[model samples]
Target: MSNALELLKTRASPKAADLVPPGPNEAQLNEILTIAARVPDHGKMVPWRFIVHPHETRAPLVEKLIANFRAGKPNANDAEAEKQRLRFTNSPLIVTVVSKTSPNPKVPDIEQLLSAGAASMNLLNAAHALGFGANWLTGWAAFDKSSKELFGLADNEQIVGFIHIGTAKGEVFQRPRPDLSQIVSKR
Candidate 1:
């Protein structure tokens, strides 16, 4: 098989906690974002943006997230709050895909949203191609209003995903995939 096809077939998301350091450096990150931006942008409307959350910001962000989680879930125990605390800090770097849909007469909102989704996938693929493990994820924090405000997301913007990027700490098991025959249909 071709190299591109081989890479596509082998690509899989590693668990966030299982991801280690040595993430994309400055140059690598720039290239990765460049690759990520090359998506199907209809009407030349780039309805997406990326938020790079590096190591230094992780602690403060996690603290804020934990507070938000506790406030939202008053019944949550210490363990649950701790889980929230470790969410973003588990990985060395996090690239948040933010969808900023605008009023467009030519292109619909759905198409712009798809572009954002494509960007997210592209980021994951780019990280993997650069020899890093990445996982696209969104949890309760993604939907929380306080968290969104903390992230500085505008009213029209939404969190598409939080992509964790780093080296895999352990073995990455390949889960079973659906057979083409089971899902494919003849036109």
Candidate 2:
């Protein structure tokens, strides 16, 4: 099969644990980001922003995530902390897609939000096409309004997802997909 067709067919997000080092280098990363931005933006309103978190920031982010998690759930345990630590650190790069839906008379914020979601999907697709394992994840850290400063997000901006990019430790297996009959309906 053609590369494009193969990617469309075989693309599945590997677990963060399965995602290891040797991710896209500088040039590849630039290419991936470039493609990620090539999504549908209604009325030329680029309502999304990408926050590329460097590897060094992972530890600090994890620390804050742990603190916040503990604050919210005092009953949380070490396993949960370790899980967050791995989620932030297992990947070589983390790109947080922020949806800054601006007030546009012509372009609704809903459309802009969709554009941001498309951009996130494009990021995942581009990374997979470039031979990298990518995962689009969102958790409590994404919705914690108090932690906007930690993520460098503005009051008007909300996180769409945290895109994790890295090399696959082994390989990804295909999971069950919904059938078209179950999802589609005739007009």
Candidate 3:
């Protein structure tokens, strides 16, 4: 019990966007992703997925996203437009977790979404435990139809998060956790 509790107590999540390049190489990243895949999947459906945007190839994708964004919002200024472009190209490695929406009546979409979320959190934790930083973020892109189409998501698929994983370029501060009493309920 103490060992399990100790690990929980020491677990720290760094700002994933703050992560820099030269992250875990291909082999290491693959190993970590493989570890993350071992999550609790209801009905063995594997209703979640991952897409890696490596640093080398992120520029084109980022440009594509920015262009798509501009198509929808033609009047965006330079700074505003640049922000959208940096989201993909900024990180050394961006791993997107996509939730697969299904028509299973017994297993609600909420549960499926939660499963995807768990997978994302696991990916972050797995990377951190392996001496790396990870941040999961989503803005206009996650819900943007054009962006989803660019990512090649299926009709029933939606993005759960876009996780940035790499080395820490700056200090990672730990925020205070909420009191358990505020959230827990007695049966």
Candidate 4:
């Protein structure tokens, strides 16, 4: 198989908690973001943008996420709050993909959303190609309006996912996948 096909077939997402440090450096991050932006953008809408959550921001962001969680769930216990806090600081690099969808006459909102999804996938693939383990995740923070506002997301913007990039702690075992025959259909 070709190299690209081989990479695609072998790429796997390591668990966020299992990811270590030594994430993409400044230059490598630039390249990854560049690759991420090269996706289908019908009507040139460019309806997606990235928010880089660097190391310094991790602590503050975790605090904010914890606050948001508390506000959203008043009765949340310490365990729940700690879980939310860890979500922000688990990985060395966190890139939040924001979908800035707006009312456009030429392009439908669904198409723009799809473009954002493609961009996120591109980001994951780029990180994997760069020899980093990456995982795309969306949890309470992604759906919580208060959390979104705290992340500086605009009213029209929504979080597609938070892409975590870091070094793998150990070898990642391949998980089960659906067979082509089971899912594919000939029209």
Candidate 5:
């Protein structure tokens, strides 16, 4: 099989906690981001942006997020808070994909949003191909306006995903795949 086909076949998202340090160096990250930007963008409307959080920035940023999350929800249990903490802190690098739509006479918001999703998928593939452990994640924080504010995302903009990138530390599980026979139909 071709290398490209093999790469696609093996692509899978490992747990963020299973991802360790020694993430992509500066050059590797640059290459990954460059490749991620190459996607099928309809109408040439590049309606997505990436927000990178390095180790230093990610620490405090997550703290603020945790604080805000806990403050708003008095009934939030320890598990909930811990889960949120791990989501942001486990990976050494976090890249957030922000979806935004510009007013265009021909293009609608859905197409633009789809382009953003493409960008996110590209990011995951690029990271995996580069031999890094990566996963695309989104939760309450992504939808919260206040949390979005922490990332400097305007209310009009929505988050497509938060990509965690790092070196693999443990086993990478292969979950079950959907049955193509049932999902795919020839026209």
Candidate 6:
């Protein structure tokens, strides 16, 4: 497998908040996404979609998130409250990966969902390999019904991840990984 495991071992996901400006340019971003779209899709449904929330209009989305958080947590202090909003606006580029399921006989919805999730991971890896920092996060906002509605997702659709990509503001130390034996199985 050309020692793919080595590349996997070296991958480091930066903290979402630590991602700074100067994100992927158009050509680079497109290349990374094209690579990501190569993830396995059962039944070839291509059950995932990407919405690149460009730098310009991200403020409104951040405002909406702040309102959602403030309303949801009435007692949250200003700093704590601001954190939720900052998560959105801080990233130079945010790729919203939506999992749009297909009602098909040959492919189970679960498989489609997995494919979408795989696509998100592929995007994260692609960004890192392209010399950028990326973080795949799904906070409370991801599961919020209102937020999903705002994204225009249909009933069968869901948010797999919000990939935050940008230059790393500082060094990100890689944490330890779980032992493969603990999670892997052999039959």
Task: Report, for every candidate in turn, its global Cα lDDT versus the true structure.
Answer: 0.92, 0.87, 0.84, 0.91, 0.89, 0.88
Clashing pairs in 6: none
> lDDT score of model 2?
0.87
Candidate 5 lDDT, 1-187, residue by residue in tens? 5998999889989898878898899999999899889997878878999999986678888899998789778699999998889888989899999998988878888889998999999998999899998999998888877888888987568999999999878778989999999899998
Error (Å) of candidate 3 at residue 166 is: 0.4
Candidate 5: the clashing residue pairs are none
Candidate 6: lDDT over CA atoms?
Answer: 0.88
Model 1, which residues run further than 4 Å from truth?
A: none
Model 3 over residues 1-187: C-alpha lDDT tens digits?
8965665566665665578877889888888788778888877778899998889988878888888889888899889998777767767888999999788877888888888998998888778767788888988889899999999999999999998888888777878998999999999
Write model 1 residue lDDT over 49-150, tens digit each, in one string.
999998766888788889999999999999988887777788989999999999899999999999999999999999989999999999998899999999
Q: What is the C-alpha RMSD of each candidate to the true structure, in Å?
A: 1.1, 1.6, 1.8, 1.1, 1.4, 1.7
lDDT score, candidate 5, position 158:
94
Using lDDT, give the best candidate's number: 1
Tens digits of per-residue lDDT, candidate 6, 1-187, equal 6557766777788988889888999998999899889999877899999989977778887887788777777899999977787888888899999999878999999999999999998898888877899999999888988788778889999999999999998887799989998999989
Q: In candidate 2, where is summed lDDT lowest over 10 consecutive residues? A: 144-153
Provide the lDDT at 61 for model 3: 82
Query: Which ranking of candidates, highest lDDT first?
Result: 1, 4, 5, 6, 2, 3
Model 2, span 101-177: residue lDDT tens: 88889999899999999999999999998889998999888898655667878877999999999898876877999
Q: Give the Cα-based TM-score of candidate 6 against the true structure.
A: 0.92
Model 1 clashing-pair count: 0
Clashing pairs in 4: none
For residues 43-161, write the lDDT of model 4, one tens digit per residue. Answer: 99899999998866678778878888999999999998888788788899999999988899999999998999999999999999999999999999999998888878888889999
My TM-score estimates for the predictions, one after another, are 0.97, 0.93, 0.91, 0.97, 0.95, 0.92
